[model samples]
Target chain A: MPVANMLIERRTFAKERGTDLIQSDEESPALTQEFMVANRMGIHARVAAQIVKVASRFNAEVCIAKSDVAANAKSILDVMSLFCPYGSKVFVSARGPDATEALSALAALFQTKFGEP
Target chain B: MINDRSSLTIRGIGAAPGIAIGKAFLLERGQIPVPRYRLFGEQSVAEECKRFEAAVKEAEADLETIKKSIRSEFSDHARLLEVQQMILRDPSIYDESLRYIREERTNAQLAVIKALRKAKELFSGLSNDEYAKSRIADVDAVGDRVVRILAGQSRSDLDHLREGAVIIAHDLSPADAIQLQAGRTLGIVTEIGGSFSHTSIVARSLGIPAVTGAEHAARLIAENDFIIVDGRTGVIIINPGETELEFYANRQDEIQTYLKQISRHSHLPAQTSDGHRVGAEANIEAIEEIVAAKDNGAEGIGLYRTEFFFMNRVELPDEESLYRDYHDLAELMAPSPVTIRTLDLGADKLTSWCPTLEEPNPALGLRSIRLCLHYKEIFKTQLRAMLRASAVAGNIRLMLPLISGMGEIFEARKIFREIQAELTKKRIPFDKNMPFGAMIELPSAVAMADLIAQEVDFFSIGTNDLIQYSIGIDRSNEHVAYLYEPLHPGVLRFIKQTVDAAHDAGIPVAVCGEMAGEPLYVPILLGLKINSFSMNPVALPRVKNLIRRSSMKECCRFVEKVLRMRTASEIEEAVSKMVMKKFPEEFHVFDPNWIGNTPLAAKKKSGS
Candidate 1:
């Protein structure tokens, strides 16, 4: 239900086709924050799904970074490939309308340990 | 046509029960071979790219449709399906496949395969994290669906599958399991899976006979090859000879007949259209029949006859063996209620164990509870085992059979409590709240129903014995057999009273004897407000369908009409009239002579 109340500030999204989506290098200041994975499962399939649900809620381009380079937070396959484990740090960066809101949602999710025991 | 094929049998796990002999419909899924072909023209390359895009779309649509049909349990896996849908749209596989198609001019199947390989390598990142394997499996699952689509052998193709064709698959996923139509899909044979796999569980739930882990089943059997899937023995015989085919065909007929020819609807819930749910449970003696019971959609084990253990053995079965049997039954039925009927043995059944303990009239002699109470040590051992199982399973219910008085109730309760205290002293676990109850079959028990209701948590009427004792006639006796009437006015009154007494005391009453399973008696029993019924598992589907079509309001009204009747034959005629009006087709299946003067052999003991 946490994702049910999500409000998008703008309707600006990528093109009709996702494969043709070229990441726009925004000159606007981007909001970035780092949080440690607290849940024992870390970023599992269910957790990755939670991240996607939160990230896709905004007009902003969400990017997640783990032990390696950042991957598209909107794409589940991309977010999962980041390989964030328990106690590992993940960096979330977004640029566009409501960038701060997206970052805040990600922060809340990480803080709650993705609702795992 | 069948002579040219190989005569072979594949051994696998019997994940379900019953028999099916039919043409094989090969559903070659989960890892299709990638076909590589070069395109000479740009037009051809573009066409191939369009094919890839369309397949991804189709696969996405398939996931969405499955998500919608996920039913009452939608939320648990709806998000997972969305995640899979996203994988279909992911840039890693989608863009890479498009790239391969445009630049390399490869076929859509080949392009999708190469792209999937690349995506898998990318998903396993820098860290050797343990989460990588399971995460990668998701990618593989999504990849497999796309590949199956590209190969034109997807699960959607199964929608057009001919009725009663046995499905042969490389493997079946939980997603595929969801789309399976129990009535249409006759049986299942998978090349790769275990007895406890999701596919097997689904097949069992649907009451479809399935054999899993049948290696090379798809390779060995071609489409339209006549085959037999024996789910009981886990044997898959491909393209049998004429003699063998005829034998298996007869075997298949026998199974359907055993189930009264309604096996297709066996998996359906016994819920009325008005949303009232009834428990369609099973009564089994042997452990192997538990599989058949579950496959037939038994909600729980209503009466587990434990006396079988003591019947055939020369001596008593040790406490350890009894504990394991009860424990396994409990664990198998986990959250479902399993009512274990304690040691219902008469002098008639103990001929193998104690030859000298025979009574001239065993039915009226010291049997069942009387025998158990007389031999207190043996009874205590069985109680201890059941209590131990109750602790582990958390769903065991103890029932004392043939209890005719409060004196016997107090004695049994005292023994049960003493064992609980002994277990508590030893620091052993058992469900202290485990319900203890009695069988409402004897005339004396029926007379004092309201008073007896206070001492017990529940009541299950054994209609067979209730009729036997109440009418003073033995069903086995040739001359007096005509008096064994289920809907006899007196018997109906007894059932009504027991149900009313239990309801007044806030306890549930169940019917587990022959009267419970008879299709003609469903509406009548439901009218009496007895919602829990335990019968032979084979009769479940037929009886459940009747329960589903009936409403509590209508059943109450019907019971009102029947209460005014004075004879069993009159009630039988009324029930026949109702069934002919409500379900005209099934009216033929019910022997209208059930309560009339034409006596049949004493209940066919095959079911129990």
Candidate 2:
């Protein structure tokens, strides 16, 4: 398999999560990943924006690396084309001032279910 | 007898009014021809290619501007634009155009049209994948638009047109309806389709009459043939012969007179002159319908469908989304009883997130409460939402659809109890006394109603499905549609039995189906001692009008008389005559509450 290391950012769930949270990953960073271009749906615009927001707060140049292609994490369009099937994982690599802390926060979000991850 | 000019009189259930005396616009299926391309010229092919690229860039700019316009008009139209953009930017469309340029040596416009036609070929065969098949419809639509634009036609997108004209299309797409100017368009009549098509929603919304599945409407009716549309009856008469013209003209006059008279009784109580009252409620699909139902004087929302929440969505709705929808519905119909059936999905309504089960016979296979029973987690999630919503509105009941026997009932009850127990543990101040009921549709359930009623709080007979299943006829099947009679002796007996069973158990029985909305069956249902009737809100006023004109005894008498009939036709004829005799002035009255008069004190004072 042509796999490349890409940073996986966590998206949180809104308040009421009963069953929706069940299918999500119980742990973060080591989550199993599937690939399909976000198709037309892209991750919900709000969810993608929130993920970008979290990455920006860490002042790190975030990038999503697929097997052959790498894209800027800040661009919703580029990340969406990566089409991470619902329960797929991508490695997170941030090389900036707040890289380690940003990676940890992203990991915790995935652990919590994207808050519902 | 043919007129000098070739003329054909088409009979359809009419949907809109007025006629235009214009040349007929014949919209043919995939008749737009592909143009030739001339890329290899005496000078240079590269220059021609550069010009084509510039034209494409220009088209792309136009597509973006249209996308923005569509977005401003509709909040969710971006979804459509996204699809359209993908098609416009698809390499296949452009590659085919380039191939035509290289092979046929065609001009830019011709090459683009040729390419789009080639792309149209991709959708020619049906795909086994449902999503793929649906996308085929989109491809055809976008292909037509692209072809039209390349042909130098103005971007007069049908969806954006707000004029009140009858739409003439080969067939309408769901996306087309979404794009339509809600306040404009009179109605749409296609030469194709049956019930549940997208055009039906458009016609219903514009409140104009529509006739679909009309094989060749485009060829037959010359533009604007002084059309008289009666959407309720699904009858369309164009350039009627002498008798026909007179009949419709008189019918129109009579309808206007009836409207005037019904206005007088609009504010009247839904009680007969002799004082037996009937509660006519509304069956709503969305929270928006709640307001329309209330405005139509619905006593309550008898059937609030929950399936819509799950439709057209990618993921399962979390408890919050469910709670918000249910709570909003409850809040809208607050104090009035709102009966919400848990996700009544069958194999036909497959969700990607849920397990897919293939069944040879889906109608008889696992669905409704049965599916919920096997999939407790799905059912439990919905029940939890309902319980939480029940706190917002005091009188919300959880209904189970397609329950056949005691087994399904007990299973649902067990799940209900489990949810209640969980709620109690959480101290969620929910109404434990709220009624729990089963829709008496399956013949097995009707046969065992008395036994089933012993455990349930209420019975809501889903007559549409009940009649179909009981008669062993699929009403959806056009060939057997005539056989799907609601008043068949077998169907009547089943309804009577179920109603009597519920009444004897001191529980109320209501009907929520197309049958409840029909004026012809109102008395028959009343005679069966049904306490409530629920239908589309538009039908509520007319049903109420029928109730006001009828006493329970009189309805019982009519029912008794009709029961003796041997055939469906005989029953229908007898009921029609009776309705004409008893309600001549208001036969199929539209908008009984349109006049907005409160029921007279004398009428309300009379006792049941």
Candidate 3:
């Protein structure tokens, strides 16, 4: 098969998987979670760095969205630019080969408050 | 922009001093290129990803090298590089670009460009916020580095800049400012910066001509344009005519001549014309500044802030470590008494080991001696170290910072006596009669100066905090900074009362604030009988020259005249006139237009 045709097929599969994950009736490849930004300084430089460090380890496309603004979780600048002040709820979504692993790691990081008060 | 090349002159804050006439070297703000291209197939997509990875690696390596080189000398800048490195390693940038290549059929460079633009857009929405704006600069810096690597461009090395080039830039980071070669760089004109910016501070230290807050200097002054930077008057004349060049040339020569005259008295005693003596001292933070203090003819070290030992350490400094540092300083400054102020940590500065209390207003909360008194063991450890150091070098005096009333001084005195007794019991040969002093910084201290003076040997007026507290203005707050006038009537009265009370109690008073160094305030302080003036090392020579030229009798009369003034402006007008009249040569060096003031020129209007 041509690469473009294969990409189209994969996109369709990913879309169907995303829908299934939202329905919660079938096994899905994607993981979605919400967390409060517990760190007093929120997603500042150091905390954003930590989030990116964890998200990059897995073969997952992670997206962290605060309000209507979403950023690539692996990009420190993107995560920091979200401007998720302390106590704001951050929505995390992962879709790829290792979406579950990426989601769990990120959730753990948020729970630890990025090792800050 | 002022495009009239022949006679255009711009004004800005004179951040640093010295004259420079040189060709302009306009630094273009580094704008990263965002190249977008569609990938042909899977092979092309993989190739683009590889290119992106290589660029990221190269950028990371470059930042690491820069960080390592500046680690020792410029640690703060090195730390900034650490954050940038983290940004480069961020997987989101890599993943986002990889996804773009796989799904969108775009090249790696385009993907990275798209990701950064998303970040930039987020920051742009927060343009009104200063914190967010600074963060935007950081984001741009990271993006620029990556883009430069992808474009196969090397970092712009300011180190090898051509000699005698005036640096014109939109803004310079602290790292860039530090990298500026003092000899090669003739002058600096920035589009956006302040007098207190890191760039300005570095320029001042290097004694280079600098003018910051020049709104569009980089755009107005083209590369290689003939420009004359007048640092004294904060003026920049571009493509000067022959007549203007000649005028500046003569003015530059005059300033140099005046500076040479001031340095000639570096080794002279600080005495008035009528032979009344006053001690000129230096306020130092580290031992390295001791030589500068001595070279500037400081009679003694009036304020040796001991917080240096406590900062940047994992644990509280041990007695041995503190003792060695203090002993060396005391011994080097021999016979010249070193007034070592106890640990003044808190308010703005805090230690990791110390218990952190959340204070809404840290400035008014537990700080300085208050923090020390609460943490008695820390205070005792420091006192033990100072006393031990003084044992070997007997010219050490203890000065307490942020004292509110007589009770704190009394408690401190009690602890001092106890420490002396403990040392004596252990057969330690420390100076038992080491003079103790209180910093009259708070209104309470000034109000109860007589009682406080009776307990301590001398008084050192910390006019920086005193003025801030009296005027109800935080000096750091730019909005209220204008109200932080040291010449205000209430402030002067507080100072006068403190000086008189100290004198009445048979003790001397010294001023170790920004006001003490200002030549404009010297005569008034002299009239108030301030026994000593402790200031920055650079201001010493000029201040000493002023003191030596003016008589005590004349200073008293000037002070009396100033004290009777109603407003701050009136007092300032009267003092500026008095300074020009008494020391016209020195006044010209400080401000050439001082004599042009109508109030100063009209001598017959109010003949005192």
Query: What DockQ was computed for model 2?
Result: 0.07
lDDT of 1 by residue, B1-608 (tens): 23434666667777776677888988754446678899889889888888888999998887777677654433545667777888888777888889889998888888888878877876554444335665666787788888888788764346556476888888875556665777778899998887656677667656789999888888999988888887765777787767557756766675566466566777888887788887899987766557768877899999998975675344476666688789888988889889999999886776655555647888999789998898788899999999998988689999999999899999999999999999999999999999998999999999889999999999999999999999999987969887889889899999999999999999999999978877878889998989599986766777888888888788889889999999888998898788777765455433423445331111211111
- Can you rank all candidates by lDDT, best first? 1, 3, 2
What DockQ does each prediction reach against the true complex?
Answer: 0.21, 0.07, 0.17
Q: Which lDDT value does model 2 have at B428?
A: 86
Candidate 3 interface RMSD value: 8.7
In candidate 1, residue B300 scores what lDDT?
Answer: 94
- For model 3 chain B, give the 10-residue run with minimal summed lDDT: B596-605
lDDT of all the models against the reference?
Answer: 0.77, 0.63, 0.76
Candidate 1 vs candidate 2: which has greater lDDT?
1
Q: Candidate 2: which stretches are off by over 4 Å?
A: A1-4, A7-117, B1-147, B159-164, B181-184, B191-194, B213-269, B286-295, B307-324, B343-362, B426-431, B476-483, B560-570, B588-608
RMSD to native for every prediction?
Answer: 16.0, 10.4, 12.1
Q: What is the TM-score of each candidate against the true structure?
A: 0.49, 0.68, 0.60
**Better TM-score candidate (1, 2):** 2
User: Best DockQ goes to which candidate?
Assistant: 1
Report the Cα lDDT for residue A28, model 1: 60
Off by over 4 Å in 1: A1-47, A65-70, A82-91, A105-117, B1-7, B29-48, B65-80, B103-107, B123-137, B144-164, B250-254, B257-608
